[model samples]
Target: MTDFLNILLRFFHFSSLLLLTGCLTYLMLLTPAGYRNRLEIRLSPALRSSAGVALFSAIALFALQTVMMSGEITALSQPDIWSAVAGTRFGHAWLPEMLLAAVSFMLLRAGGEAARYLLLVTLILQLILTAMTGHAAMHDGWRGVAGEVSQSLHVLAAAFWCGGLYPLLLLMQQGQRDPQDNTAVLTMMKFSRYGHWAVALVILSGVSNTLLISGIPRHFSFWLTGVLVKSVLVAGMVMLALLNRYWLVPRFRQSPAESRRRFIRLTQAEMGLALGAIAVVSLFATLSPG
Candidate 1:
């Protein structure tokens, strides 16, 4: 039950935070200036809601970790145990995570261009802090520092690519409504322009993180199986994205209606695969990497 709760909370936390990061990236960077305000306003409720979920999940994860560390249900009430937990490496990371999460929630609630910019900064910091607590922190000295950096990049790249899909769907809806509006096409082109880099970084840093966490497994293990599954799922998403970009996009003008239906369907599948990948990560993150 404890383990179950741990994975569940981690999934929720990761999903919500990833959503916030990706959607914000899409709004600030991908969407055109004319569409930014409307998109932001439309997305505000979801942004704030994700922030709230992230903050609460961070608190719950901390409490759960305390119990895991102290091996007692009452660890939360024991000052000594709390202090001990706080002194650990996870504690170091969680401290800043909690702080950033709180600030992010407040900023999202405040709502505005300025608040969003601030929220983005805080959320990026929060993602970086995440690298400090997990398998990336296994090494010491320079190697550890390098691992954290790689892991941070991995998280950022993945967040930007996967999280941006939500807004992309919204943008597609607008295009569907106004056949004359080329905003969605232009925005998608913008996303594809930079998204290639994001995808490459996700793959590169993911490999780096895996190597840093545990070298090639000579034997079968749950961790190895999870990694394989995740790789396959990600590969599926990449293939679908390529099909949409190369096969459908060029012919969009020739058959806008058909292209729209296909693109939306493919994008939805990609989102499902992304969620599956996240679920796999959440589960295996708690297991031994070896």
Candidate 2:
């Protein structure tokens, strides 16, 4: 039951973080100024929702982690639970993330450029804090610091790749409504360029994290299996992205409608793979990194 609760909380925490990071990344970097107003209207509700979820998930993770450490569900009522939470590594790392999540929730409703940027900064900090308590931080000294940095970069890059998908799909929907407008294609081209960099970073940081956390092992384990699954899913996402960037996106000029259709379909597939990867990550969090 504890394991179940842990996995559930991790899923929510991971999903919420990804949503917060991806949405903000898309709005700030990929969104075209001309389409910003319309996309903002569509994205605001999602941003607000994700922020709320992030806050709730952070609180729940804190409570559950406290309970896990105490090894008693009734620890919810113990003073030592609070004390442990206040003093432990995980608890110390989580407090600021909870505060940031609350601030981000409120800021998402502000609906201004500055507010959005601030929200992004808050989310970035929350992601970094998350890295500080995970398997990356289990190491000691400079190696631990390097692990944390690599893990943080991996999270951010994953958010850019996975979280940006929904917004991109929305933009494609807009393109469908007005097939004449090339803004969607242009924005996608820009996003694709950024995505290449993000994917590269994800790979580099992921490799670093894998080596740091588990190293080159002679035997298979559940955590290693999760990592392999995540890698395969990510590879699939990258392949689909390449197909869109090299083949389908170019067809937008000659076959706008068909290309848009194909792009949306491929994007949906990519999102599926991303969600699968996130599930693997959540499971990995629960498993011993042997």
- What is the total number of backbone clashes in candidate 2? 0
lDDT of 1 by residue, 127-164 (tens): 88888887877899977898999999999998999998
lDDT of 2 by residue, 156-215 (tens): 888888898888898898898898777777777778888899999999999999899878
Q: Provide backbone clash counts, one per model.
A: 0, 0
Clashing pairs in 2: none
Q: Which stretches of candidate 1 lie over 4 Å from their true place?
A: none
Residue 99, model 2, lDDT: 90
Question: What local lDDT score does residue 206 receive in model 1, on the 0 to 100 scale?
Answer: 89
